[model samples]
Target: MTREFTTPPASAEPLAAPPSRTNRGLLICGALAGPVFVVTVAAQALTRDGFDLRRHPISLLTLGTLGWIQMSAFIVAGLLTAAYAIGLRRVLHPGPAGSWTPPLMGVFGLGLIVGGAFRPDPALGFPPGTPKGNADPMSWHGIVHAVAPPLAFAALVLACLVIVRRAVMLRQLGWATYSAATGVVALVLVAWPGQDGLSMRLAVAVTLAFAWTTMLAFRLLPPAG
Candidate 1:
């Protein structure tokens, strides 16, 4: 009997390459940024002398003998946030939301770094020796620090709006609503004029915004190969 020529099974198409190690690392960095920042600040707030969560800001922690610790925390958190922004750029689907969100977040991170580098003026009776109710005249660094947080907050709010659009596209109504609400609440809290609770309100605002950011990083994690 004549041997029939047999064709080898068609080679399977090559699988797509897995995500890069760099990408994974960036995602991890992003994921850790919020928690690291929150935890560091929380610890300092709880233990540091002359810190009043109701009257003084977390930023004021940059003024005392142990100020270096808070400053370092700010710098480190900013770097991690920037790294996550890169990962967002890579992982998000192409669109207006995707195009703008990463840059906005990147700005937020840069602002944090800049704000840390330029410490705020002593105000609201911090550092144990300053006047209890009077804020010092704005120093150059204080002016810069004052500007940075608002700018960063603006960028973060814009990014949240952009993310709302994307969430709607994904048919996630809850996320979309939450995103928009987060922005609105942050704006309200930040803009509130009551000095009595300003510190606490601002802390809440920061927590809400960064917590949203951290959640986003978790959402953007690439699927395991």
Candidate 2:
């Protein structure tokens, strides 16, 4: 009788890493949240007369909460964007990826911060005649609000372009395509007439779109597969 060698059962430790399903879900949620917040803010701005911040203190309270959420979204998005950069660093030419990383993320983060400062609040209300504040020629917040979107868009555009280029070089077709599409959509949305225009309604819509896309892209960075 041949003595059959008994192989020990596999150890409890995983040999291969598990897929980041949870991470992916978190990313999707974050992305969706950004857009949702944007839509909420925009809706409020559009219906400013209807939204009495003073009478319904709850609504004011709600706006404050949403603002925090918006800020959180930016922080999360920046982190995710950084992670994507790291992944790209693994595959791309050292010099370009290295050079692009800091400034790209730096500006993106700056956009979020500045954008936060400029975010319109009907509750606080800007100087008279400046609807959405970004359209306000006289007020400083208006100018900041006006300029912030473009700056944020520029940063995003750069980051996305670099990622796409690196993806192309590395022959990462899927990653490249997605990055490019996201970048393009974001750029277009930010630069669109609605955003670029001085119209308050359009500006609000564009800003919302910007926030949404940024969140969506950032979330995808972690577990897009």
* Least well predicted 10-residue stretch by lDDT in candidate 2: 10-19
lDDT by residue (110-205, candidate 1, tens digit) is 988987899988877789988776555778888999999899999999999998988876677787898899999999999988677888998999
Candidate 1 global CA lDDT score:
0.82
Model 1, residue 61: distance off in Å is 0.6
TM-score of each: 0.88, 0.49
RMSD of 2: 9.5
Candidate 2 residue runs with Cα over 4 Å from true position? 1-96, 121-136, 194-225
54 Cα displacement, candidate 2 (Å): 24
Report the lDDT tens digits of candidate 2 across residue range 68-147: 64445444544544443333333222444446744565565566556555544443333223244323243576466547
- Superposed by TM-score, candidate 2 places the C-alpha of residue 60 at a distance from the truth, in angstroms, of 13
- Find the number of clashing residue pairs for candidate 1: 0
User: What C-alpha lDDT, on a 0 to 100 scale, does residue 162 get in candidate 2?
Assistant: 78
Overall local distance difference test of candidate 2: 0.48
